[model samples]
Target: MLRLRLVTWDVKDTLLRLREPVGLSYAAEARSHGVQLQPEALSRAFRAAYAAQSRRFPNYGRAEGLSSRQWWLEVAMETFRLSGVREDAVLALMAENLYRDYCNAHSWELLPGASETLSCCRRRGLRMGVVSNFDNRLESILLRCGLRHHFHFVLTSEAAGVAKPDPEIFRTALRLGGALPEQAAHVGDDYSRDYRAAREAGMHSFLLHGHGRSAGPEVPPGHVLPTLSHLLALIEKG
Candidate 1:
């Protein structure tokens, strides 16, 4: 039987998701500053800007001396610039609003079964922590979402100096949990970052299937969970 003691979770898209589309949020911010941007266009531009920023400043630029807020401001600026908003003043205003707006719980919603999963883990005497490629604001967001108390610790990429799929973050989680890799399990929606990375780290991993979405045939049957509720059975069986 698997001796599961620690369960580390990936936050974004795993435990919680944005309440609205990124583009809608960004466009709202733009509108506040007298700019009208198509939400779809802004969303696409944001994705591009975020990817470029990640390549340039991985882990929120922790090693490069950029604070989380500063790094995000850079991403926002790049996002606006890519979407054809060149005015520095306007870019700053929009980005600043976005940064502030996203920090609150209103910006995010707990995923289905998230609370029940955590409560079940707690009932099973499991220790839980968060392992995510997020910035310092993660704790605050969790707190506002009323999920902060469920975790023993919250580890972010900015705090760890590395992101998921690097393995170092998983190692850090092991140290925090005081468990061997085999004594822990990880669950997340992303295959490479969460499932594969955790498996490579010697822990059991599960890829969460989207609601009303089917798992691809390529995924191992046992490793893809239909919902967080399925996780309870895994723990019980183990």
Candidate 2:
């Protein structure tokens, strides 16, 4: 029998895949303000700014931090500057609309075998939860994706006041789910944020290798599974 008490999952890039082109909505909004930007250009600028802001946020147990929405707001503003879009109001509106859409958007595809694996975990009597580095709107997004019911606890960085790579985020999930660290497992696509933090917190860690080759000196030593099904098999075997 499996010894796990809880199974926690990361949100983006692990369970759900974005279906629509990211910048298409931004491009449409830009056009409304008489600005013309290639979608690819906008996407690149947005990604760069987003990553920079995330890095600026306090790592681990710092008191000061930006919520995912606040961080993305800065990214959107900076991206507007990078794209030479001069309208502040337009940028703000786009940011608000895009975030709202993201919460309610079904423009995503759940990964193959994800539902089956989750169901199997549930049937095995393992309580499931989510510990994600995201804004307050993460619950709404999960609900829209029909995943809200699957998780007993959903902790976001905004709600927890600590982001991943910090043991506190994982601890919070354990506390909320009434599971000890040793009785849990965390699976995510991020090596540093998920694998390293989960293991440090005394939980088993699994790196879900999705898209992109593994790149980084800080990648953790853990089971690297290509698909959610593989993880399910490991859990079952344990």
Scored by TM-score, the top model is 1
Top lDDT prediction, candidate number: 1
Backbone clash count, each prediction separately: 0, 0
Stretches of candidate 1 above 4 Å error? Answer: 211-218
- 60-165, model 2: which lDDT tens digit per residue? 2135543566666667778877888777788788777676667775667798878888888888788999988777777888888888888998888777877888
Pairs of residues at least 3 apart in sequence or in different chains that clash in candidate 1:
none
True-structure Cα RMSD, model 1? 1.5
Q: What is the C-alpha RMSD of each candidate to the true structure, in Å?
A: 1.5, 3.0
TM-score of 1: 0.95
Q: On residues 83-169, what C-alpha lDDT tens digit does candidate 1 reach at each position?
A: 899999888888888899999999999989999989989988999999999999999999999999999999998899889998889
* Candidate 2 lDDT (Cα, 0 to 1): 0.80
